[model samples]
Target: MTTDTDTALEVTPDAAAAEFDRQVRTLLALGYPALSGRSPEQFAALVAPLRAEAVARAGSAAYPAGPAGPETAPAVTGRVPFVLVVGRALAPVERTMPLTTLHGGRLPGFVDRSFEPGSLERFLATEEARPPGRDGVHLLCEVERGEEFCGVVPGDAMATVAERGRTPLTLEEGIALLTLFPEILVKNKCFSLGGSRCGDRRVPALWISKRAPKLGWCWEGNPHTWLGMASAGARHA
Candidate 1:
């Protein structure tokens, strides 16, 4: 009595193991271990327990895609919780890395003028901004760019997210998403990290600038035609 739907949902042990291995290699290639000050072995050990869970979470269905059109469509929408984002490990200047595919010579990621040293830490420290797990590695499931909310004010969109029982992504989560999947931040489809706030009007966001990704902020009450708030369905230890 095994239906096709049930079969599709079942992940074989081999498939799960393969998924975990791919994630480990991908993170290593992205220099996650160095960013977190952990050896490759240590990093892999941390993520080992969540192998099957990560793969299942990554396969979960996502919300409707935005109107970025096929040209700018993301290869993958949801992040599989493999990124290791040490919030305080490096300054914003050193933390952000430009995508290798960007035109012109290699460029580094930059924080907006509105931010200063330790600014991100303070914002992330707020109880309102605290992530679901500890300050180290964690899992975020069904994370979306919230592109459907584009042109909608962040404050209003957050209210809507709450009504739907979804969680807005934190600053660390946003950083992780960009660090792992730079293609998701294409033109006219940037996202706001509304989950991280300092009890003010500002909402952190990631966007493309001069063919590079930039971590910046915008007014909570404002709306942008291109930037939508990001969110997650759940988080795990």
Candidate 2:
């Protein structure tokens, strides 16, 4: 398993702060306000309090073990307490912005043409995906790329996650993770956002294609050697 947490780099309070700031700037530069319907100041205000604790919380939490095995967990380098998530309001362009912005115009992120907005809307978060905290824009805690579940069938991965008392990443959460840490979406080791699902077998996933990131779907029962399931430990304000 790859074991690359949020990003391939070690997480320190300083790194966390830098990354967090970068996300804000990136979102604004990319005109996130247009999609999110929140002003830059509003977004800035939401994260101001978090800045105060960045130093205290950074590199403090233990990295949880991956579902495949304990060894698949990354060493305890450091942890960013929260990941700023913009939610599902920008579902139509979530995947594209991250890829285009992060990749430096190499290749734009691709969304399957079949997933028209109406069809994409059907893939709601599973019951397990709901967090006890405010469900709108918020911070996600203990996020992981779920590398241990690589090569595991999406259906089996979901069952394993349930048995382990954890939640899989929703489509929005998955996009948020990638938008903040593009390095996690490397070739031959992509991930599925199994927390969001349609009535049938399709599982939303993010993968690399032509050296670019792609938002697509995979059958629940099929196992792909390149894809693992992404997950988060919890969500909060």
TM-score of each: 0.76, 0.77
Which RMSD values do the candidates have, in order? 6.4, 6.1
Kindly list the per-residue Cα lDDT of model 1 for residues 14-49, writing each as its tens digit: 444554565467668867677677888987786676
**Model 2 TM-score, 2 decimals:** 0.77
Off by over 4 Å in 1: 1-20, 56-59, 62-74, 77-106, 125-129
User: Backbone clashes in each candidate structure, one number apiece?
Assistant: 0, 1
Candidate 2 structure quality by residue, lDDT tens digits, 1-237? 223453333346665566567666766776666665568797677555555454455664443333322122232222223566766754344433444423343676777765767877788889989644443565677776776777898999988888878788887777777676565677666889888888998999988876677889999999999898877767665
Highest TM-score among the candidates is held by which one?
Answer: 2
Evaluated at residue 228, the lDDT of candidate 1 is: 87
Model 2 residue pairs with clashes: 59-78
Off by over 4 Å in 2: 1-18, 47-56, 62-81, 90-105, 131-135
